[model samples]
Target: MSTAMAPEPVDNGGDARTRRSIARAVLANPTMVTFGALAVIILAFSALAPGLFTQGSNFVQLAQNVAILTVVSVGTTFVIITAGVDLSIPSGIVLGQVFAVQALKLLPLGEGTTAFDATANQTTALSVLVAVTAALLGGLIIGLINGVVVAYLRVPPLLATLGTLGAGLGVALILQDGVNSATYALDPVGNGALIAGIPNLIPIALVVVIAGFVLLHLSVFGRHTYAIGSNPEAARRVGINVERHLLKVYVLGGVASGLAGFLSLSYFSTTSIGGFSTANLQAITAVALGGTSLFGGVGSIIGTLIGVWIPAVLKNGFIITGVQPYWQDVAVGFVLIAAVWFDQLRRRSRDRG
Candidate 1:
């Protein structure tokens, strides 16, 4: 009887049924879920303060406020998809601004002097170009450092980037001390236009986001990146150039950071060294919270865009609603943790099967 019983514990239908259930759940409309959340937030805001929520001025302000963070978050989505983190973004942004300002100070400030006064600086576009270039270069250099440290030195991304975070902060401080600079005034000439009605920076951000989406979703290189992140050893076994591709991804992230910094300079008209550490962390959290698996290879630009904006929207909404500013931070922290926890649960369930 025992031998007969042991002969076969044959195919049970249980596993197949469980798999079907999971497949069905996964196939449900995710877009509706995202949109629903956005709607709830909008409705909540509008109900609380109809005028603030509906005003055109408020809408424009929100757009301008989110632009920098949205751009940075877009770049970070690429890195996190590869199961990596970039902690140096804040520093990179600060350094770019500093470098850009200093470059402007050096270029023909006056006939005999080495620095430009407020009047001279206010009228020139050259300084803006120089500043933007410096920002881009600074970001590229930081990204390369990140790649070299992670890919070659075998440093963990978290630890390596943390080191860069500190180093970058130090560099920013040095630049700040060296310059003894004051605020840069925004140039009013052609303020209402770009090369046309659309600002150059807006077009630049759109192009970056669109091109990044295309590269990540539609290109063979994107597939290879996902393959590498999903399983590095397997990717290499299939002859994917893992190291080179990773380096490129890191550099691209840096370039994105640099561009974000440039936009920020335009937005603020002044560089503040003290108030951006949180910005970098928030961008990372936004990417992670947007349903992008921290384990890698499962996220989208559209999701990241949603993730980035939700927090910005929430903060802006709170300000409009007279919620204590500190509460916004607490709320964001909770949202980030909750999202990560949910993601973990999802991953575990998938693994169990």
Candidate 2:
């Protein structure tokens, strides 16, 4: 009789333990949700807007729309991984465009007469190099200021970058006299495709994403970045140069933003001085949505690449499905909030695990 009574096992925490294990795994690698979410979103949109969203040309157009964003987001991935933010992305982009245009203006040219003339609506090897270099250098300068202020002067990254954003935009506006510049020379970089159906921008973005993956996931530099972000004091104790590393991270972010601007100009064949106003926010959203913690210490460039498509898909899908375009922003806002909330849940899982 006693044996029969003992047959009923005592209540245990086995289920709870299983849950904690899963939560911990999710915490360790958070993008599972984003991957699932991306799939669900795509399926739902395809079902809801079959003809427009499912067409071949629309997919190509969508890729083109997000190409520059992919480049910007990869850089943002690095900064956010270190528990830092860069609000000056728009500034870097605009300034890069302005600098590229200025570089073009400085080049000697024949109007519509030579194959390699800026004035002839064509770009030469030298002009392309000068333009790209000037744009990249412009970004580096902005990044330097951001790094110095945050790392050395000890300003908060958010505040430091915000200040840089305002100041840099002012400088760009002043330089361009509030007007956008135009050029037909760099169109190939934007529109040309080595593959018959693929745009050049897609491959450029692919290269950057691959390079970023190597930098942030495989290299020693990434480990240090995670260490600093996870625990700066601990990182310092372990002999990491936190300040210098932060500076480098910010510089990389700046350069990426500048490159985005250059790409934007190439694609559009002009600069929108007032364009990209929300680019920094959009980029940060893509980074965060990709499961890179705003609180820092974890990230994936591949995840970010997936994240970049969410806003784009939502915008295109909503419009195609007869939903109001403004709902795009609302949908993205909710998704972002959910992402951050999930991040908090992940932290809790870590604590429990």
Candidate 3:
């Protein structure tokens, strides 16, 4: 019997065309469209409220106001990239503030008693630093629990974080009721300056945002996050330790949340039981608005920063333009819905193509 020669492999010319078509379709997605729309709105508002929105002092306030939100949103970006939702971040932040404040009062200081009279500038500075450290530690511990439950125990992300959310809120409430010193306020200050116009929180927030973006965008840890989020099985099969990477991701998130909490304290100066209830949601919304996929993988810290700023800018502008405070929240809700819708459109177009 004569063996027939093996047929030569056929090269299809359709693959490149299909890819280009898909690329064009994705570019038309709602997320990209809304980002452009939001930019227009910001510019329009800036133009209309030139006196109020474009002022130097208003810019400073904007920076300070959005700082905490930006920090928390960065953490959410990491969690979401892993196809996880961390509802516990707000509670963790609140407790961090509470513990940090408590630590300040209880910790020893130079020639000071357990009860500190924060009247002196030097003592005040030291206390604030101590408070920041305490908050950071609190976030780290909670993050560790979150990572352990999800990674080792194979618990669902929502349930794991939900448990921590309730637990953390309870802890904050306990701190408020037990410590009586929960209402202390921070005084804004300039360091013995003859002439100066700057809010200290603005610098801190800038630093946090830039540093977080760098770590998440430029580091190996960040690359691993994308790898796991995009394909857990493939990442593992390639020798990437998924469990360990997950733990580190959650830990970094916790640290970011802690820093956010400390910053919140600086802005509000008091830790209330009801505080930050909507913060986690807001952070998630910001992350989503910035084009981060809720289904895992794909995200941008720069986009998050812009997303955080837009809402804050709109809110501030609305207040200045005499709109009812309640209307501002309503407007933000509408914008968030539009953004999600856009993201959905993008995903569908990409999938279809």
**TM-score computed on alpha carbons, candidate 3:** 0.84
In candidate 3 the C-alpha lDDT for residue 250 amounts to 81
lDDT of 3 by residue, 1-353 (tens): 23357655444658997788766665664445556756786688778887887788888778767878888888888989888888888777877777777787786654755423454343466666677789898888878889999888989889998898889888877867744243343444212222356666666667777887887789888888988988999999999999988888887778888887777765666665477888888888888878888888878787687778768877887888777767768887888887777777767767853
- List the candidate numbers ranked by TM-score, top first: 2, 3, 1
RMSD of each predicted structure: 8.2, 7.0, 7.3
Q: Best candidate, TM-score-wise?
A: 2
lDDT tens digits, residue span 108-131, model 1 = 766654323445245556666776
Candidate with better lDDT, 1 vs 3: 3
Residue-level error in angstroms, candidate 1, position 78? 0.9
Off by over 4 Å in 1: 1-32, 113-125, 178-180, 183-204
Candidate 1 weakest ten by summed lDDT: 183-192
* Candidate 2 vs 3: which has more lDDT: 2
lDDT of each model, Cα atoms only? Answer: 0.72, 0.87, 0.76
lDDT of 2 by residue, 176-198 (tens): 99888778778777777878999
